[model samples]
Target chain A: AQSVTQLDSQVPVFEEAPVELRCNYSSSVSVYLFWYVQYPNQGLQLLLKYLSGSTLVESINGFEAEFNKSQTSFHLRKPSVHISDTAEYFCAVSATTSGTYKYIFGTGTRLKVLA
Target chain B: SAVISQKPSRDICQRGTSLTIQCQVDSQVTMMFWYRQQPGQSLTLIATANQGSEATYESGFVIDKFPISRPNLTFSTLTVSNMSPEDSSIYLCSVEDLGRANYGYTFGSGTRLTVV
Candidate 1:
């Protein structure tokens, strides 16, 4: 079984400021990590994912996350954020096994970017 | 990523009523899933819809309460039976993206259900 924990429920940041959302997970086996963004009235979009190889992954939107095996964490960060970046971000994990792909999502973090 | 078309973006139903949400993928997908997002909670897997076979449900969910149907590789539906206030939540359907290296999942826009 796998579970994800998002440390913060809401984050307030000024435009062009930095932000980080913490996420930790517990799984007995190797798992794939993903960050998804959900804008207002829109569906979830894949920000970036860490499956194998590099411990660091980045999204096109100036966001990046590190897969820390020792810390059991995958925290999303952005050096500067835009007002349009205001949205809910989710951290998810699923077993690396081929057949089963049921994802366990963390409680979402609502990022409120202010002007 | 596979594009999904989900019907009934939102609805308000009376207690004891049922709602059937549909999910249609643009291309063939091997795996389809049903998920629920309760208010202020994370997304939880409800079941895995297997084409031409019975769906596999998670621990707390049941086939009776959440009947799933996958008649083909590109389509699936989930019915929330005998709904109640507690059942009010955002229901989303996802399909596995086989083209991706990680086989990431693509989600629908979701159907927001409100039980009165």
Candidate 2:
């Protein structure tokens, strides 16, 4: 079974400050990693995904994550954040092998950007 | 990206009643799933909605309590039977869009069901 673990439950960052949300996973087989953001009263939206060929995956909104296979970590990073970036982020993992296609989501990290 | 349209954004139902949530996708998808988000908790997948056959439910979830139906590739529905206070949660519909190298999932806004 594949499982995702988000280390931080809540993180507060000032505007223009760097932020990193940690995520780790446990899986026996190769897996795909993803980050999702959920704003207030909204559904979960995909931020970025690391499928293959790239250790670092980036989103259009200045968010990036690096997939480190040795460490079993895929941490999300941002050079600077804005007040609008305040949202709950989730780390999810799914198997690359065939037979199943269910995503295992982490507990979630709440990014509270203070102006 | 796939677009999912879910009905009844929020509903306040009395105990012993049942509520059905519907999800309509704009395009055909092979993977459609149902998830539940409880208060102050992470999203937990309820079941995988298959097009023709019976839905595959996760452990701890049963067909008698939460029945699911997928009539086509673009539509699915989930019904919560015998509503109770414990059933108060946000129900979301998810669909996957596979690309050549990568894929991402899209979700409905979610239906907030408050059982009283």
lDDT of each: 0.91, 0.93
Which candidate number maximizes lDDT? Answer: 2
User: Per-residue alpha-carbon lDDT of model 2 for B1-116, expressed as tens digits?
Assistant: 78899988999999999999999999998769999999878999999988989999999999999999899999999999999999999999999888744487788999999999
TM-score of 1: 0.95
Instruction: Report RMSD (Å) for each prediction in the order shown.
Output: 1.5, 1.2
Give the TM-score of each candidate.
0.95, 0.97
Please name the candidate that would achieve the greatest DockQ relative to the true structure.
2
Error of 1 at B66 (Å): 1.1
Query: Over all chains combined, what TM-score does candidate 2 have?
Result: 0.97
Model 1 agreement with the true structure over A8-115: per-residue lDDT tens digits:
999999999999999999998998999999998777888999998899998888999999999999999999999999999999998854566558899999999999
lDDT, model 1, position A68: 99
Candidate 2 lDDT score at position B79: 98
The weakest ten consecutive residues by lDDT in model 2 chain A span: A94-103
Q: State residue B75's C-alpha deviation in candidate 1, in Å.
A: 0.7
